[model samples]
Target: AVESEAEKRDRATREIGKRVMEGWRILDKKCDDCEVPMLTQGKDDDKGECVLCGKGQKKVLTEEERDRAVSEIGRRMLDGWKLEDEDCCEVCDLRMCSKGDKKECVACGPVLPPVNVNLELPPNFDFSDPKALEALLLQVQKKTSTANQVPPTPALSEQKEVDKVNISAPNTPNRYGSNSNNYPNTPSSMQMQYPNTPSAVPVTNEEMSMIGAEQKIREGWTMMSRAYCDCGGPMMRAPNSREAMCVNVHCVNSCY
Candidate 1:
């Protein structure tokens, strides 16, 4: 009874092996006859033309189709062939897709590395009121005003000084030493006088005469004021009368 059971088990095992081999053959044949390129299941997927014979209508695989195929292949390899858990999804594991290579996986979406995404708080932040904003605006205005303030240019200052000098100078012919007629016809035999130094005075006869005339004019003004009337009008007082009268008799009559 033991031998018979052993024999039955052996036969069953062989049959199973044969069936598995046949199944594998069918799968291999299908793969060989497949019009799709090798790694093209996920990568290129231009189809309808036999990969080996180059026959049939061409059709390109969509991204979704490629992803599904890759996932399906990975699932089959993982479950049916008993692959490692890490190898379950080639797309997720390798993160790449390539053309014409059976090992090429589908593209998985880009995976970002773990990072510190939280933002840091700003220093001395206050957003509840307008005081801070107003202060900031004031500071900006001050800076702007300071920047806009332009110092008086040297040229402008010099021009103003020139204007003052021109206005203050007398409008006489020889005011700026241009006309020689204002001085004596003959040059005076005089020397320049320097401060704290012994020097000859350059007074000519013409200048002396002018000085004398100016003194006489002053004396005449003094005498005229004493002999004049008290009414402040330009009227001469009589030599004998203490009371003053205007030269215009009509003015005196009108006043009286």
Candidate 2:
């Protein structure tokens, strides 16, 4: 005999209840249909969900309502309902969980990586220097413009000339004392090779204020706000400070 839709739903509900019982907090609020109490999880108890019906509470859990809340997020995650986002589901206030793409209720399953990708800078990049910034941007533009354009086959003579320029350019010493030949052709690798390169200009008071900001950004500090710096680079809110500051190394007006 085949199972009916109601039976399938009842089975799914039972499975969810069993999972929730392992760690989730049981609430006093009963499901009108099932007559069973609801359950919840999350730091703020922001995820009140019906264990049998999988319906979520639309309103905030009251202080008395949530007095039964427990600290079982660790254990629940270990049971495989990982990557929770509170109140993400539109149909139910239940927490959404999964690894990627399918974000269903805790029992339904899905998750995604955090959306923000950190803005990476090349090693030893001097954002404050006009010349260095110009060079880097121009190199990036050149790479972009050529990436899609297919050139006609170069004649042997032309190819030799290109190779000669490429080879000789590496021997030229940059503002830093070291020859560029020590580095790879890519901007990131080139920067990596010049760890000891001294800044061409002296650091000003404005630039000094921006010092710890970049490290904070790299460490995943949330952006508070943004505006354009005088040099066209973005000035972002400094962590734990009211002022917005530029991340540019060459711009003297780094903060306002």
Clashes of each: 0, 11
Residue 92, candidate 2: C-alpha displacement in angstroms: 14
lDDT of 1 by residue, 41-114 (tens): 22122222233333433334455454343333333232222212234332333323222322223333222221
Judge candidate 1 at residue 30 and give its lDDT: 20
> Which stretches of model 1 miss by more than 4 angstroms?
1-137, 149-151, 154-172, 176-256
Worst 10 residues of 2 by lDDT: 160-169
In TM-score terms, candidate 1 sits at 0.13
Per-residue error at 118 for model 1, in Å? 32
Instruction: Provide TM-scores for the models.
Output: 0.13, 0.21
Candidates' C-alpha lDDT: 0.28, 0.39
